[model samples]
Target: MSDASPAPVTAAILVIGDEILSGRTKDKNIGYIAEYLTNSGIDLREVRVVPDVAEEIVAAVNALRTRYTYLFTTGGIGPTHDDITADCVAQAVGVGIDVDPRARAMLLERIKPEDLNEARLRMARIPFGAELIENPISKAPGFMIENVIVMAGVPSIMQAMMDSVAPRLKTGARVTAETIEAGNLPEGGYAEGLAVIAKAHPGVSIGSYPSMTPAGFRNQIVVRGREPEALAAARTEIEALLARLQAERT
Candidate 1:
């Protein structure tokens, strides 16, 4: 029997905007996209936030699109002069960009023909030979070229774009996780044991998260893996380690 597993599907996110880089517009799309990708069986491996500069956007688009199975970019696709994501993506993928007829038709759904001036037409610009992603909230559509998926900067619009593009994406085995609560347990106390468990279970990822509560420090150890058996085994070891430490403290 062939025991080789299928290649893992991975993705990266490029958040483009000067406002995000300057902290003026706090990004909400990254977290939403991460969770959405996770649930869809695609791992979000890397996230990069760059300014509105064309060079930076193009460089990030090229680098990320080549490295991962898919690259999702949010921001810079708007009506203003600063919305240059579409042009940068075209440059990165070595394709010519112009106002797509299909996209223009979509824009016409919400915008009057007379009001469809230069700036609004910018939203209709798409890379050549790329497919359009529907924006149900607004008429301005996002586009996908090669492995790069362009989206809006606004959280609501970006979320809607995700729904439109998700069905077409390639996916892999969905990762599952088990969380073990270590009440008032210091991470320092069980760090070594947790590391040992993590090393033993090569297929599973173990992480210890510590949070401050009104009672005291609360620690959560999460074991994540695609295989149910591996996750359960790791969770068992983690729970045992926590119990041993708690017993020793008493």
Candidate 2:
């Protein structure tokens, strides 16, 4: 049997909006999308947030789409003047965008035909030759053109769109993680030993997270990797190091 693993599937997120950049509207989508991608076996390598400027949006879209296996964008598809993400994505992909009838139909489901004015029609604009991503919440559909997936900025709608597109994505080996509860153990006590084990494993990623509670400070050491054998070996070493340090304190 062959031992070679499949090539990793990677993605990046591009958040567009003046509101997000100005701190007027706090972004809650990045973390959600990051976790979603990770669970789907797609590694989220980078995230970039840009304002409503067309040039900046286009530049960022072009850069990230080329760098990763897929690029996801949120925000700027609303019915306001600042909503230019669809246009920017079209420009970056060198395609013309127009009001897609299918998208208009989706809007019509939630909006009265008489109420579907120009402002509402803005949500129907989609890049040419793109597949629509269903939005169960608001019914304003997102779109996928080649490797770029565009969705609404709202947390609920974006999450729905992510679920809509999940099945179609190319996925790689899922990453597994093991966490060791170090209790009050200080990171400095095992930083060097942890670093050495991390270097030796190479495939596993080791991280120490500290949190505070009413009782005292608590620390957790996490080991993550795609290979089970490598992950197990790293976790064993980390546990031994922590135990040695605890014994020294006695």
**Candidate topping TM-score:** 1
Per-prediction CA RMSD (Å): 0.9, 1.2
Candidate 1 global TM-score: 0.98
What is the lDDT, from 0 to 100, of the residue 58 in candidate 2?
95
Backbone clash total, candidate 1: 0
- What's the alpha carbon RMSD for model 2? 1.2
| Model 2 spans > 4 angstroms off | none
Residue-wise C-alpha lDDT for candidate 2, range 78-157, written one tens digit per residue: 99988999999999999999999999999999999999999999999999999999999999999999999999999999
For candidate 2, give the lDDT of residue 176: 98
TM-score of each: 0.98, 0.97
